[model samples]
Target: MREIAVVFVLLAFLAHSAMGEEMVFFADDLYKAAATPELHASLVDPAVAPGGSTALKIVVANSGRVLALLPTGIQGSSLEASREMQEELRSVDALNVVATLTAKDPVSVLSGPATIPLLPSGTAQPVEFLVQVGEGAEGPYHLDLRLDYEHQIDVRISAGQASPLYVPANVSEEITIHAGGSRESFRADYARSELWPGENGTLTLVIRNLAGPAGNCSARLLAAPPFRASDQPVSLGYMQPGDLALATFWVEVGDNASVRQYQMACQVLQDGESSAWSSTIPLTVAVEEGQSIQIWLVPLPLILALAFLAWRWWQG
Candidate 1:
């Protein structure tokens, strides 16, 4: 009978020990599963003008919070447990964050990636990036936003406790923005579209105001190799919407210019405004080969008159 009782007592002790171990393991698993981070991102200003540079503002926020209680079987006093709970709650904070902005085609990110040392829970941070919209870009465009960071996932407060565990995380988002507005427009017309090598001619540029009214508007020609311009900038004084103005430039073709079409650019600007507008008007002109017979024919009339006079004298 004594031996049976001792055996029964030993079995009960073993069962209690096993139950405590199981509870401790369950508590650790609960802590790891409850602490998680959630991040949200949005653009502050969503409208931008084409052919211009603007600052893109983005706001990043942390919405994660502690919603579960600490499980039982973890050994700690009431005060100690409160401290541990607070530390666990901070596990949702994002650390060492980096945000990169990207776009396709007509939109370009001019600034580098933004970095944040730490972002606390229930808080937000604003980041600004300089971006450029292409000259031909219009309508709506999408920009890619990526965020990389690390956050605490688990914390150990009992025996054999070490540092908190941090895991790497990433988030991807898209920002949409409208990129179009009223801007200056121009068109070019050449008075002499065709020219001969070593020839001088005139080029006429017709300017039409498609945007708002402007004062002291002027236009200039930008000539490249094989083409030379001797005219200065022409003033249009004041221009209203849908108004048309003409600018003429004296162009000289190089002697050894190739017999092909060449492209040139025209620049337009406003006099008293801090904002300067530019448009690429690809004005093309063809250079043709000069005929030797046509050159000789120019002096044929004078030569014929002199020969006729001399022949009459000789005949007399």
Candidate 2:
């Protein structure tokens, strides 16, 4: 009988401890329902670039409060497709007024020596910024968002952190175009490589003039095969000499597309005339896994000639 009583007492104490512990969860601030949409865009704009830079535009709206001690200067969550997608959101201080946006105290809201009072309910007045969409990012990315919050329950007897990520359905599509080249030089030679289906990588465009001659140039990427049939065409803008251009794109298998022997090419432009285009970079996009595609291959004739010459010299 005493053992039963002891067990009951232990369970009661544990239950009470758990109940009083605070659990932080995210809920859309009912008052600012309209702001939620804006917030979503702001949060994502900095990190989104798809189907060339021409398709990029910044979007912002304040959604409901994402409950938690939202960590600052961290990529909350994003889909990873573009070669490099970067986004930043911060409220260093309020614009109209001055105050520290990420102040230590929940009640403290000051932007640059300007103090902004809290909302009527003592809610943390948040100032968020979703600034500047990245340029020329291709393909789609669903950034991983920290959808949940952290809290302590059971009268602070225990604490835990939670990351809530919603399952993603294809929300947006992206297509990026870039020239193949050595990271050191966006020269014409390095840009010639066949891209296969299921192959994805960054295209770096380095536009340089004749060194002495001053001129304007444009770098363009045309979609072919698997990349061509995507929803719509992605256009790369005209790049000037010293134009630092980049785009990330992906290649998915198409109905008729082969993992072997696909075609894509690169074209360069100066003034208005196009440079002698690079060789057609041939590729073999695979499906069921037969062989790794190599966009760059040695010419058969060159290989045979070299082998013959080596044999003759060895005999001598």
Candidate 3:
């Protein structure tokens, strides 16, 4: 009888200890709620070009609270469900949460100060990360957001025995970004490749705004030695995305221009700055010697008169 009582006591203590330990599990709905249409991450601006800075907003709402303690084997007795139950609800400091952003393609983070600093319980915090897309970027990209945090639970065993337990919290979320605008909308190319020395010809250029927002824009040509721009600047008032514009300049080929190809520059001007918004492209100019001309036709009346005069002289 004595041995059986000792065995029961040992079992009860084992059961109690198991119930006293705290176990932290993330709510299954945590990530799902964030992925919802209303809470999903989004870009502040719909349009962004490579090397341009844009904002990526990440919203995280933690509904996860300490789970209730399980009942112990002893009748009319309960083990503290969890350490958190010993203390009332506490706010999770934003400083405890650490967030990192990554993508399949490399991106530069420009958001100042910090990312996802103070996240309170039962409330959503929208964190914005200013970032610049890398070169060679195209439409449709996925960014990986990793959040690491610590949940501190107050454990009180007795007077002067209060201690805090730290639970590591880690969560990963993937957000989609639709990157647009390839380089600039405007394109520059030479209309004609060949030029003749000492001749006035049209330097035809075709400019097109491909796949971008509409705005007021202007264009200009920059020429080097042996190539001169007849028109310094041309007005391209309002151009919509994918709009095409044409500009022609009458250029005189220098008499000293060599037969080799010379490069001319053309670009789209920015609204306020002297720099060009679009990339500068080389316009190839090839100078060739003028072709020789020969007269093949004479006046019919003069030829007939000369023939008659010759006949009269021969007859005399």
TM-score of each: 0.47, 0.23, 0.37
Candidate 3 lDDT trough over 10 residues, lowest sum? 29-38
Between prediction 2 and prediction 3, the one with superior TM-score is: 3
Each prediction's RMSD to truth: 35.5, 25.3, 37.2
| lDDT of model 1 at position 242 | 78
lDDT of each: 0.60, 0.29, 0.47
What tens-digit string does per-residue lDDT give for candidate 2 at 198-286?
55533333333322333444545444424442332223355444444343334444333333333444444446544433323334444
> In candidate 2, which residue ranges exceed 4 Å CA deviation?
1-187, 191-214, 229-253, 272-279, 288-316
Tens digits of per-residue lDDT for model 3 on 145-170? 67777654333333333344455556
Order of models, best lDDT first = 1, 3, 2
Candidate 1 C-alpha lDDT tens digits along 1-316? 2232233233333433443311112234322224445676656545566788989877777765543333333345665566565566676689988999999879999999999889987667878999999996755588888999998755666553545667788988777665653334644433335455578877777778777787888876555435566536778678887788888777787554433344555556578432234443444445444522110111446444645655566569
Ranking by TM-score: 1, 3, 2
- Please give the distance, in angstroms, between residue 165's alpha carbon in candidate 3 and its true position after superposition: 0.7
Candidate 2, position 142, lDDT: 30
